[model samples]
Target: MPSLDTAKAYYEYFNQKNWDGMISLLHPEVRHEPNQGEPRIGLELFKAFMQHMDESYEETLTDMVFFTEPNDERVAVEFVVNGIYKKAEEGLPAAHNQKYVLPAAAFLGFTDGKISRITTYYNLPLWIKLVSE
Candidate 1:
């Protein structure tokens, strides 16, 4: 459990669209659940998930802030993520080439200086409304 530096680095990696680079900051057995669709466990699956996101949207997290829990073992991040879909996103309400900005929250759990688990939640209705507009 470090400080905001590590957390900021993680976001920077994501913002840069560096999927593989971000993977290096996770543990081998890291687990990720994005808005409860399905849990992706292990480094390979997590990388795959990021790859899917990279392929689906041109997005960035703006106005982001991180709140680290006690001992810095967990972090709660709040941000507004904006994306323009070039390829249809898996759960999107529309076909393609849509733009969206959604408020999102994510919990990150860490161990041994890397992320062990992450859970993300977002406003679905807001996402739909924006992307489908």
Candidate 2:
């Protein structure tokens, strides 16, 4: 599969909460760059991050639009994260099932038909305000 297909599957699996499915599309030494954070490398670290995320939030990606370069080595996707804060995360408000809509995007890098890197972006303050209200 090309980078675009892998990216579509990644978000599909995420919305379905299929962590293993998401992992299957990743390279063994995948690098994850969360918005405003240090890059995390390797599948194991990715799994741990996913587990932590799963425990805290219930989210679905909506209004998705994907873009790619001619060589298909990279892909960028835009979407909205419709989510409910299920539990508390560090430096965030107490969770009372607060719902938030966050517009987000990701840049994907592929290696051998798998995603080797992912850098994601979203508005943190908007999320905080929406959920806090």
Candidate 3:
């Protein structure tokens, strides 16, 4: 495994919208919990999330800053994902038509150089307002 460069490679990959590359960095049994709601687990769900992103946004991370804490087992990153919403994902109201930048955070737990778990945080009201506008 390579020594992960927190700000450079990671965000660069993200800003480029390289979902496959992003997914490749995750563990097979990875789980992503964005909040207290349902949790998305495994590669299948992860792919679905990527698909949603592809269909929903026509932009990249802007005004982004990262704060990471990594040890032998995990890496926690909190960031502000500022971007315009050019598309909408399913199950979400038709509010993603306008431009809005939202802040989000992801806390990742790693094992064997792969992300085994991830928890994401974001402001739903801000997102909703942006999309609805």
Candidate 4:
């Protein structure tokens, strides 16, 4: 499948909260980088991170647009995250079911039809301000 198509499918799985389906699309050695955190290597860590995210937040991506090069090895996605702070995360504002809508972007690398790396970007301060209100 095309890289953009794969990215779309990945987001679809994400929006559906299908962790297994999302994991199935990742390479065994996939690397994940959050907006303001260290890069995590391997699928196991990625799965753990997903679990943590599931426990802390309820979110969905909207207004997605994907960009790719001719080789289709890399894909970039721009979207908005519509989320509610469901549970308190460590070292952050208290969760009171606060709703937030933030613009975000992600760059993905593909290897042999599987996602090799994913790096996401967003405004953390803006998110904090919105949630802290």
The digit string of per-residue lDDT tens for model 2 on 20-131 reads: 9999999999999999778999999999999999999999999999999999999999999999999997788999999988999999999999999999999999889999
| Clashing pairs in model 1, backbone N/Cα/C closer than 3 A | none
For residue 12, give model 3's deviation from the true position in Å: 2.3
- Estimated TM-score for each candidate: 0.91, 0.97, 0.78, 0.98
Candidate 4 wrong stretches, greater than 4 Å: none
> lDDT for model 2, on a 0 to 1 scale?
0.95
TM-score, candidate 1, is: 0.91
Tens digits of lDDT, candidate 4, 5-109: 889999999999999999999999999988887999999899999999999999999999999999989999999999999998788999999999999999999
Candidate 2 clashes between residue pairs 3 or more apart in a chain or in different chains: none
The true-versus-predicted C-alpha distance at residue 47 of model 4, in Å, is 0.4
lDDT of 3 by residue, 1-133 (tens): 6324533455577888887778878789889887657999898998897787677776566555545455546555666666666665567666435766777776667666777787878888777776776
Which of candidates 3 and 4 is the stronger one according to lDDT? 4
lDDT against the true structure, per candidate, is: 0.82, 0.95, 0.69, 0.95
Q: Order of candidates by lDDT, top first?
A: 4, 2, 1, 3
User: In candidate 4, which residue pairs clash?
Assistant: none
Report the number of backbone clashes for model 4. Answer: 0
